[model samples]
Target chain A: MLLLQSALVQSALVQAALGALPAARPTWNLALPGQLLGALGPDLLLAGGAVLLLLVAVARPESDRHQRAVGWASLGLVGLTIVAVVAYASRGALATEGPIAVDTFRWAVDIVVLIGTGCTIALSMESNPLDGILTAESHVLVLFSAAGMLLLAAARDLILVFLGIELMSVAVYILSGLDRRSERSAEAALKYFLLGAFSTGFLLYGIALVYGATGSTNLATIGEHVARYSLMYNPMLVAGVALLLIGFSFKVAAVPFHMWAPDVYEGAPTPITAFMAAAVKVAAFAAFLRIWLDAFPTVAYQWHNAIWLLAVLTMLVGNVVALRQRNLKRMLAYSSIAHAGYLLVTVVVANSLGASAFLFYLVAYTLATMGAFAVVIALGEPGERNQEIADYAGLWTVEPWLAAAMAVFMMALLGFPIAGGMGFFAKWYVIDAAIHAPHPQTVLAVILVLASVISCGYYLGVVLTMFMKPRPANAPAVRPVPTGTFLVIYLSAFTLLLFGVLPNGFVQLAHDSVPISMVGAPARAPVASAASR
Target chain B: MYPLFYSFCFYLFGLIAIASALAFVTRRSPVAAALWLVNVLFCLAALYVMLDAPFIAAVQVLVYAGAIMVVFLFVVMLLNLGLPGELADARGLLAKILAGLAGIVLLAKIMSSRTAVPIESLMLRPDSLATVARIQGAVAPVAQPLFTEYLIAFEVTSILLLVAAVGAVLIGRRRAAAVEGVGAG
Candidate 1:
């Protein structure tokens, strides 16, 4: 009896010990927001939209009948999210404690990304290869990629940046090869995957080096350490910064590292290419600007010239190579690279105006590219790739609306004035910032203007081919208008022109949306506290 | 001596990796390229071990070398690419020129990069066995935070992967059926 009692006591003690040990940390409760209402607002909405899409795909697996409905609903949801993001921005209610800041800066990019995603979804619904892949995956990947882009634009740490880049890239790599029937598509996916993995290696190693030099992956902490200790000359840190630049430049399709751009753009579904050229480019450049501006502003003297030289090479190479391209998508791919050069000029200035210019240019770029892709999707027939310049000859005759939309895209891309649209203002802002920079950034500005001039060659080539070139005697005529694709084309064109003409309102919002709370808070407060002093 | 050891190990692995990477790209035989890529991955694993990221090093070898490379080999063989003419057609002139240019540029960049300083001095409280242990303990919380903060994202990623897997299977199955029909016809 006594032995049994002792055993019971021992068992009780063991139970107590087990209970005291931290419960295997719950996965779903770690960093969830406190207030239930705010907790799942945006995330829940995004999830709900995804679930609805999944349900739609499952309900009608083989039929393409209600595809137009899916496109319309997706666009409406995306538009709603843009409004929600704007509301969040205005209320200043985006709360977070991690390396990602959820603020107005993020909101602006989110709006642009969502719009780009909406256009891609619309195009995908119309005339992709549709190789037994669910439309849900397409729309879901677009949403997820946009979310990742938002996170990337708001990242304040190396870890967050890497995570965001991987998230966006993995989805895109898969999206590029969606139409597995096409050898070109598969080849494009393989090339992008290999190159992306290679660039990731550089980014990861650079992060390790940066962490080693500063003993932190947090951007603000690194900046503070570098400022106080003057370790800009540290070889490891310098190498890390340079490698990081290369990795991000690759993501943005900058020169030299942009080898994958033309092939991938030509090979992928037209909409995905448009999303990549517009939204993904914006997100990458935003993150790139934020990282450098926050962590390496003091070390600008060291790496400034490297970036300048890269900007010059990127502009020259992108524009010159584009002039020789016969493929429309490949030409746009190079044109996007040239735009990256213009954005890099803003980074060269490394100031508030530079930040504003990036945001403004993103709107114009997104609208124009999405509009262009929409037109391409609308005009293209099955098995008849509209990528070749000759394929678009006399488009003005059959599809005058599409030809007009394409003209808008080409003119905006060339940065032509007033009638050409707000793209001119976007270019002017970037140039002005570069010229007025505290540093010697005017050189980048000059190169940027020259590059824009070079861009006119290909842009006009497309316009001339569509308008002036006569049609073949017995070319296949356009069939009845497809409802879904026509919607995408008209909407994209409307947005492009609307923003171009009255860009001031959007430009102001972007300027005010800068994520200054983290880095510039101290500078903003007029009176320094005793602690600060 | 410790710094020299680190430098030597980094260079040794780096050279093996670079050579294997070149082999992977240049080899005409897809099977041979896959093997060389495995070698490159193995070298990278060793370098990770020397850098004190033993867990990551293990994951790299296990996931990349073991799983990914095996899948790559399967796909290459399944495609039945034994035609001599087919193999020869793969290496175009443009590819050769681009590869050469890329290789030279990469080599120049690597050579020009300044030597990185050793990191021991900057380690918070000077890294020790105890510090590593502490970090390992903290990893649970770090992981916890990631899950909580990104629960939707994590779940979505799982779903995405599942969909992709099923999609790939569906595509392969459909293609197989179409081939059967053609053969019967």
Candidate 2:
């Protein structure tokens, strides 16, 4: 095989490239292979997996056989991804001046994305006639998007950030439209693509302006240039920051730019929406945090208040709009937008606590969202989509356990204190970051809390419908449940409870991931200019 | 040696890009718009060559021009959009006003901010038109910081692209099969 040979060749090339570097001297802790793989391994493996899955799909004409192959192979590929992560993790953190920073922070976030993708794949394994479209591509796209998110989490260069954003968006564009059986999926895809391309132009223009202003795309280099040249608060620099904020805000689905969220989320399959909600948000926040952490620290005084305004607006708009949605999926979509706003408070803080809060909240949110979507996929019937809240009018009779699991997920998402729940802790961490931020980020924190209270209305609405409302006598009997759906649901629920109870494990993990002090790089001031003072 | 060849390639592509961009804006028909978009993609690929980002350029061509644009053209043809009427009637007052305002603002900003970027401290400086690799080598010191500190992040970017390709093909293939089944029926 060509596939095996290509893998070997690629690995050899990577090894050669690493060896050829002038500073190829092996650091005591990190083997060059680990260091290189930490950066490129996920991409290579996903690429290989994509090829393998494609080949397997084409090679096997039998649909059943293909589905089986897709399920196990996806599991295998995710397993390999875990191996790569472990390999990179074992090598520990490396301090380099590379365009991407690699350390525990990135590795931790990678695990959450990878796990979420794995769960989505598992939830997708049922025998819908639509599975033909939903098959291996969903897994591959999730992997690709995850890869983009991982790169974004660690990117230290504006160009790399742009590339990562495209990488994530392109895959998502196709996946969102994967269910061609419905017209809405195609509509969602088209809308997302148009908006995504427009935002990309804004981002590219911003990068050009920033490059023109600072003559660099490397965040650290730009920081140095600003410090050395005293160009902080320069008009061009300020304009560049504003444009960058607009572009990223759109990606994260912040207010005003969030028109695409409810439609796209409602249009795409529930599992895919879960991926967008959890993995995409985490990665976007990761990149957003990195940019603000490295480049905007000095000018935080100037940019801080502006971001605070956006944060408040996004939170308020997201939560308030979510209250009226009749569609459960659409409601969650609005809630997610609101959640993005809530997380924005921490990002606005842009400190050690903020970083940790983001990491912790990301994990908690991913678990809760993935768990909720898993239930949706289980309840949903073929050809008949389940967007209506009225559809769940049940005595808790058809599926009592399912209803209970759904209730827990809803409560967690609302950040309600369900006794040792991760949701409560997740919100607390974000609020804590906002409260203690070196700057006066508390006002944003107040908005975050108020928006969360508004969130309780919709989240509780889902619970009331699932439990109290009665199913009609003429309702069709629920279909036999698949093994995969059950597996995903229980796994998500277990983790949600586990993390909630043993909050410190995840808290410590989050604490360890904050990019406070990097190796081989000096602490970059916010907006100190090279020519300043 | 390589830089010379690469520069020629870049210019060739750059010309194509500019031409396509013009076509994209000028074209009245949706089909023409799609086609011009493809051309713009090709030009972008060429620009990538000059920029020394061969991988990205290749993706720009393959994914955008090759795969994505084909989809766009397919949809445009399928929709059977009729020819457009005269622009005089089509242009609403709001549209004309917005267009004028945007153009004026853009022109004003560009004219006001026309100062050239200063690069006196840069060890090697390439003009905007140089090959990407030349730009890379000229900015080798800049490359040092990117690779030395951000190397891990760089490799992860490659994985992201691979995933995008796989995701696209897989998603496309399913609908493709369904479309075929319907056609046969």
Write one digit per residue (lDDT tens) for candidate 2, span A109-180.
777777777777776656334434535445656666666776676677798888888888888898788776
Clashing pairs in 1: none
Could you give the DockQ of candidate 2? 0.34
lDDT of 1 at A204: 88
For lDDT, the strongest prediction is 2
> What is the C-alpha lDDT profile of model 1 across A347-387, one tens digit per residue?
78777667777777888888888877777766666642655
Cα miss at A43, model 1 (Å)?
Answer: 4.7
Compared with the real two-chain complex, what DockQ does model 1 have? 0.10
For residue A34, what is the lDDT in candidate 1? 55
For chain B alone, what TM-score does every candidate structure achieve against the true structure?
Answer: 0.58, 0.48
Tens digits of per-residue lDDT, candidate 2, B1-185, equal 48788778877877888788777766777777778888788788778756666766777888999989876776666566635443335557898689879988998988876895745665444544234445455456446646765565565566656665666666567677788889999
List TM-scores for all candidates, in order. Answer: 0.75, 0.77
- Tell me the lDDT of model 2 at A52: 73
Find the candidate with the highest TM-score and give its number. 2
